[model samples]
Every structure is written in structure tokens, then in C-alpha cells.
Target chain A: MHDKLREHIEKIVPLSDDEFSFVCTHFSIKKFKKHQFLIQEGEVAKHAYFVVSGLLKLVYTDDTAKEHIVSFAMEDWWESDYYAYFTQTKATMSLECVENTQVLCLSYEDYKKLCDSLQKMERFFLEKANFGFVGAQRRIISWLTSNAKERYDQLLKQYPALIQRVPKSLLAAYLGVSRETLSRLAP
Target chain B: MHDKLREHIEKIVPLSDDEFSFVCTHFSIKKFKKHQFLIQEGEVAKHAYFVVSGLLKLVYTDDTAKEHIVSFAMEDWWESDYYAYFTQTKATMSLECVENTQVLCLSYEDYKKLCDSLQKMERFFLEKANFGFVGAQRRIISWLTSNAKERYDQLLKQYPALIQRVPKSLLAAYLGVSRETLSRLAP
Candidate 1:
């Protein structure tokens, strides 16, 4: 499990074995059954999880109580209510396990402590966070400028595996479109 | 001038006078006349500029040669073709001085050296880059979901000074709307 986690971290910032082991010591292995809530809105987000196996969905609900899918994370991906995690505020989003899964969870406090202890780990987190920000910005731009079909095409091009794992309705919500519209556009 | 820059850097990371001075040594001041190009499309973007005085416009031109304003930087702001700078690719966007400006420019090589020298400076740059990404994502989402008037109001709320300094046409381009429409909506 440590080796697998290290592989993901190495993609962002190469870490020595000792540095990786030190950072790994802070993570708690969590297992969730399908349809379980890892996080819920209105509570402070304490931890961010990296998927070791299975899938998770990040969602927000509207005033009408309709849930909108914001993002999905599979193996090697990280998920959390970042606003709440970063600001120590109540969460506006929720996280649910879409499949029975295992994750490596790290509390913000532990993560900060790990960063202070390991320079490579700190750089790794910083680089990953920056890259994630850039990706989010690009996704937002694509959503604003592209039509439904174009957006669907872009999603497929970027995350082909997600199409197989995520439901069409959830994918529609992620794309900011209706289920019927997405169905028509899907190949 | 160095004091002002030091204060700006301190917003993200506390830096001692010695550290600030060391960071400052990596930068060179450059002056630009109004409408001067700091960077142009097809050229490799080599430097990121921190505005000390005046304003700069970041824009992209389409195949038809029509320009779209991406962003404008004023005093205490930083501007660059970040995509090009991070990836070391030819710039697709251009940076032009909207007014006579003085800026502290840091080449990518010098910036990397500074990051290696000071861990705090590295974290500062990473955090700022992440903040920019988050801001850009929110801006795109707002553009997609909000009406023109709401967007204009939000833009003013975020950058009150831009309304007075930037031309309406450029603002319209940034908002992805026409100049006439923006003029009609302006209070």
C-alpha cells in the first residue's frame, strides 16, 4: 500500500524511500462500502483521502435539494471538500463512495506536520495542489466555452476510464447538463 | 520600492529582510511605454512580471486577429503567460502595457534558483499560483451561470479600480461579451 501511494506522489515530486515512509506514517487506511458517505455537508472537513481502490463522488446540493456531481475520484486520485479543508469552515460539498473502496486518509494537521518534517513531501504536496488548481481552472473554462457535445467529447478525451465507471446522470451533472441531453450525446 | 515588494510577498509568506533582499536580487526592473508589448504570441515566454506601477493587459488573438482580453494587472499584481511559463512552450497569449508601467521581471531560471535558495519563497509562489487557479475557475463558473449585469457587478466587487482604468471594450472582451452590450448594461 505504501509503495502504491508512493507511486502517485512520485508522479508529482520524486520522493526518496525514507521521505515517502515518513509521510505515509501519518495516513490512516480507510475502507468504505458502496453508497457510504465519507464526508457530509455542514461539518468541518478534517481529512482528504487518496483512493487506493474503487471510486468516490464529490457532490453539492442546490436549494431544491437536488444533488449536482462536482467531481469523481478513482484509483490514485484525491477527493475532499477543499474549501472546508483549507479554511476550516463547514463543508458545502459531500463525498460518497460509489464503490466499496479503500483510501489513505490524512488529516490536515498531520499533513502539515508531515510537510514540516519532509521537504520532498512538502514540495510534492505544493506541486500537486498547484497542478490541481490549474486543472480546475481549465475545466471551468471548458465548461463556459463549450457546447454540450463539445464538453462531452472533452471529458472523454481527458478521462476515458471515468465514462465506464460513472453513471450517465452523474456525468450529466458534472457537465452541467440534463440527463436527457447527455444521453443523446453519448456514443 | 523594495519595501513595497517585500510587503507584497509577506502577504503569502513571512520573509525576513535578508530573505527579501536575496529574492529581490533575482529580479530586474523594466519600464514599458503605453501599448508596448511585453510578450507576444509565438515567442517563448521567458519572464513573469510583478507590477510596481501602472497597468498591463493579458490578451489572446484569434485566427481572425480579433483580441480577447484574458486579464489585466495593476499595481502590486503579477502577470505572465503562465501556460507557456510553466510548460516552457511558445506563448499563445500576449502581455501588453496598457499604460506606461514599471515592473520587476524574473526569468524562469532565476525564479527556480530563488526557489531552491529559499523554501518559504517556493511555498509562496506555489500558493499564489494555486490561488490564481482557484480565482480563474470561479470567474469562469460565474461567467457561465450569471447574467451580464451580475458578472459586471461581481467584477467591480472584486476589482473596483479596473472599472475606472480599463477601457469598456477590453472589459467586454474579458467578460466574453460585446462592447455595445456592456455599454448598455453599465450604470
Candidate 2:
């Protein structure tokens, strides 16, 4: 389990064995059944999870109670209500497991403590966070300018694995299109 | 000057005066005239700029040679071709001064060095990067689901200062709308 976590961190910044061990001590392993809510709207998000297995969805509901799927995370991906986590505000979105899931959970407090102790981990988190920001910005630009078919094509081209694992309805929601539109564009 | 820089960093992390001095030493102050290109496409982006005065626009050209305004930055805001800087690839966007601008520039190497030296600065960068990622994601979702008027309204609500600084044509491009459309929607 520690090896899996180490591998994930290594992709961002290679850590020495001692440093990896230090980080492992701060994280707690968590298991969730299908349809379990890892986080909910209106509550502060205290933990961010790194998925070791299974799938989870990040979703938001509007004032009218319409659900919009924002993102889906599978193996090796991290999920959190980042705004709530960073600002210590009530979450605007919810995280739900779409399948039985195993995750490495790191509390915000522990994560800050780890960053204070480990320079390499601090660099890793900063670089990874910046990369995530760029990807999110690109996704926003693409969604704004592209049509439904264009979005479907781009998603298939960029994240083929995610497209393969995610349900069409959820994908439609993420693309801001109807289920029928996504169905028609499905290859 | 150091006090202002410290205030900027303090928004993200509480930094001690000594730490702020260490971080500030890595930054070089630079000035750009209106319409001058701070960074150009096809070149590696060596530094990220933190605006101290005036405005800057980040623009990308599509296949057709049409320019798309991605963002505008004013005092205290950071702007760069982050995709290029992080990946060490050629920049896809160019940074241009919209007015005579003064900025604090820090290279990637110096940034890494500062993060290694000061844990607080590293945490500040990580937190700001995470906030940026979440904001970009929300903007993308809004763009995908909302109409032109809605996008305009959302932008007005979120970044009214940015809207005030940028020209209508540039704002339209940033919003992925035409100048005429934006003109019609504006009160």
C-alpha cells in the first residue's frame, strides 16, 4: 500500500525512502462501498483522497437541484472539494464513490504538517497543483468554444481511459450536453 | 517594495519578515511599455510575472491566426504561460502589456530555490495554485452550460476588476463571444 502511494508521489517528485515513509505515516487508508458519499455540499472538506482503486464522481447541484457532473476520478487520481479544502468554507460540491473504492486519505492539517517537514513533497504538491490548474483552464476554454461533438471528440482523444470507464450520462453532464447528444456522438 | 511583496505572499501564507526577504531577493523588477510583448509564442517561457502596476493580457492564436484573449491581469495578480513554463515546452500563448506595466519577475529556477529555502512560500504557492485550478474548473463548467449573457454576468460577478481593466474587444475574446454580441449584452 505504501509502495502504491509512493509511486503516485514519484510521478510528481521522486522521494527518498525515508521521506516516503514519513508521508505514509500521515495518510490513512479508507474504503468505501458503491454510492457512498465521501463528501457533501454545505460541509467543510477536511480530507483529500488519492484513489488506489475504483471510481468516484465530483458533482455540484444548482439552486434548482439539477445535478452537474464535474469530473470523475479513477485509479491514481486525486479528488477533493478543493475550494472548501483550501478556503475552509462549506463545500460547494460533493464526492461520491461510483464503485467500491480504496483511497489514501490525507487530512488538510496533516498535509500542511507534512509540507512543513518535507521540501520535496512541498515542491511536488506545488508543481502538481499548477499542472492541475492549467488543465482546468484548458478544459474551460475548450468547453466554451467547442460544440458537443467537438467536446466528445476532444475527451475521447485526451482522456480515452476516463471515457471508457465513465457512464455516458455522466460524461454528458460533464460536457454540458444531453444524454441523447452524447449517445449519438458515441463511437 | 518588500512590504508590498510580503503583503501579496501573506494573502496565501503567513510569512515571517526574514522569509519574505529571502523570497523577495529572488524576484527582479521589470517594466514594459504599452503593447510590448513580455513573452511570445514559440519561445520557452523563462519566468512568471507578478503585476505591480498597469495591466497585462495573455493571448493565444488559433490555427486561423485569430487571437483569443485568455486572461487579463492587474496589480497583485500573477500571469504566465504556465503550460510552457511547467512542461518546458514552447509557449502557446503570448503575454502582452496592455498598459505601461511594472512587474516582479521570478524565473523557474529561482522559484524552485525559494521553495526549497522557505516552506511557507512553498505552501503559499501550492494553495494559490489549487485556488486557481478550482476557479478555472468552475469557469469552464460555467462556459459549457451557460449562454453568452450568463457568461458575461458570471464574469462580472467574479472578476469585476478585471472586466474594468480590459477593453471590450479583448473581454469578448476572453469570454469566447463576438464584440457585437458583447456590446449588445452590455448595459
Candidate 3:
């Protein structure tokens, strides 16, 4: 699991053995079954998770108790109720497992320590954050300019593997369409 | 204007005079009249702007020749065709001055140089990027769960000053509503 993380980081910044070892010390690993929650709304979000394996969904529940899919994290991706995690507040969003999962977790304290101890890790994280912001900005553009059908096609093209793995109902939620509507749009 | 930039950076990380001076060397200032385009579709986005004063709209024109408002940047805000700016490609959207605007421009090359020279700037940018991602996530959640009226109200609540400054037609575009519909909703 740690090797997976090391490889992800090394894609952006090469790390020496000593550096990688030091990086490992800040993270702890855990396993969860399908339907388990990594973050629960109204509780403090303690760690930001990096998925080593399996699938997870970040969701928000409305006043009517309807679920809205915020995003999905799979192999090699990171997921968190980041507002809560960064501000040390109660999570308004919840993260739950969609399949049996393994994740490497980094607590806030350790995240700072790692950045302070090694500048390269800070650079790596800065690169990740930059692209993360860009990704979100693109999503906002998609929402503003595309209709449901266009969005569905865009998602299908961008993450065909993700579409294959996620259930139709969940995919419908992520695309902000009724299952009937998504069914019409999808092959 | 430089002081505004320094104050914004100091909010997250305090810099020494020498450090701030080095940072100033990397940015240049420019002025734009209303209706001027800072970035145009199909042209390379050479700078990521830090707004010193006035308003700008980042717009995407769809194949149907309909203009959609991707976002608005005002005083103390940053705006760019970031995907293009980071990747060194032609812009897919255009940024136009909504009012006479003064901006501090940081070219991609200068941005990289500043990050390499100052660890504190990296930290400051990392913080900005993280919050920018979080803000976008919240917008996505709003799109998923809220109706137009709810979203309009949320926008008014969050940025009351912005509403007073922005024209209703543009706000309608941003909210994905027809101008008539927005007029009915706005006070």
C-alpha cells in the first residue's frame, strides 16, 4: 500500500530511499468493507484518505434526506471532506466505501510535519493542489455550459472505467440525472 | 497594488522585506478598459492575473454561440484560463473586463521561478489552491441538490456585494437561468 503512494509521488517528484521512508512514517493504513463510512457528517474528519485499492464515494445528504453524490475516489486517488479536514471542523459531507477498500491515511498534524520536514513533499502537494483546483474549475465549466446528455457523454469519455465499475443509480446521482434520464442517455 | 498582493500573501504566510521584494520582481502590472479581453479563446493565456481593482468575467461560448459565465473575478481575486496557462495551450474560454480593471500579472515562467526561490510562496499558493478546490466542491454540491432559486439566494447570501456590482443578465448566465427568470427571482 505504501509502495503505491511512493509511486504516485515519484511520478511528480523522485524520492530517495531515506526520503520515501520518512514519508511512510507519517501515514497509517486501514481496511474497510463495502458500505463502511470513512467520514460521517457532523463528526470531525480526522484524516484525508489516499485509496490504495477499491472504491469510495463522497456524498452529501440534504434536508429532505436525499443523497447527492459529490465525487468518487478509486485506486491511487485521494478523497476527503477537505473543508472539514483542513479547518478541523465537523464534516458536512460523508465518505463511504463502495467496495472492500484499503486506504493510507494522513492526519492534519502529520501532514504539516511532513511538509516542514521535507520541502519536496510540499512541492509535490502544491502540484497536486494546483491540478486539483484546475479539475474543479473544469467541472464548474461543464455544469455551466453542458446539458445532461453532453455531461453524460463527457463523463463516459473521461472515465469509461469508472462508469463501468459504478452502479447505474450512483452514476445517475453523480451526473445529476434521474436513473430514467441516464438510462436514455447511456448505451 | 503591490501592497494588496503582499497583504493577501501575509494572510497565510508572513514574508520578510527581501522576500517580498524578490516576489515583486516576478510580477508586472497592467490596466484594461471595460470590454477589453485579457484572455481570448484560441490565444495562449500568458498570465494568471491577480486583480488589484475592478471586475472581470471568465466566459465560455458554446458551439451554439451562447455565452456562459464560468466565473467572475473582482478585487483581490485571481482569474485565468488556468488549464491553458498551466499546460501552455490555447485558451478554451475568454476573460473580459467588466469594468476598468488594474491587475498584477504573473506569467507561468515567473510563477515557477517564485515557487522555486521561496518556500513560503509555495505554502501560500498551496493554501489558496486547497481552498479554491473546496469552494468549487461546494458549488458542485449546490448544483446537485439545489434549485435555481435556492442557488441564487445562496449566492446573494455569500457575496452580497458582488450581486450589487454584477448586472442581472450576467448573473442569470452564471446561474444558468434566463434573464427574465432571474429578474423574477431578484429583489
Per-residue accuracy of model 3 over B30-139 as CA lDDT, tens digit each: 99999999999999999999999999999999999999998899999999998899898999999999999999999999998988889999899889889988998999
Q: Cα deviation in Å at residue A26, candidate 3?
A: 0.6
On TM-score, the candidate that comes out on top is 3
lDDT of 2 by residue, B36-84 (tens): 9989999999999999899999888877777788778898889999999
In model 1, state the lDDT of residue B133.
Answer: 58
lDDT of 2 by residue, A101-179 (tens): 9999989998888888887888888877998999887876575457789888998999898888888888888888889
Sort the candidates on DockQ, descending order: 3, 2, 1
Fnat for each predicted structure, in order: 0.21, 0.74, 0.84
Model 3, stretches more than 4 Å misplaced?
none
| Candidate 1 lDDT over residue span B1-187, tens digit each | 6677898999989987788789989999899999999999899999999999999988877666778777789999888887787677899889999899999998989987887778888778866765675576566446534678889999999899878999888888877778899998894
The 10 consecutive residues of candidate 3 chain A with the worst lDDT sum are A132-141
Clashing residue pairs in candidate 3, if any?
none
| Model 1 docking category | acceptable
Which residue segments of model 2 deviate by more than 4 Å? B14-18
Go through the candidates in order and give the clash count of each.
Answer: 0, 0, 0
Fnat for model 2 comes to 0.74
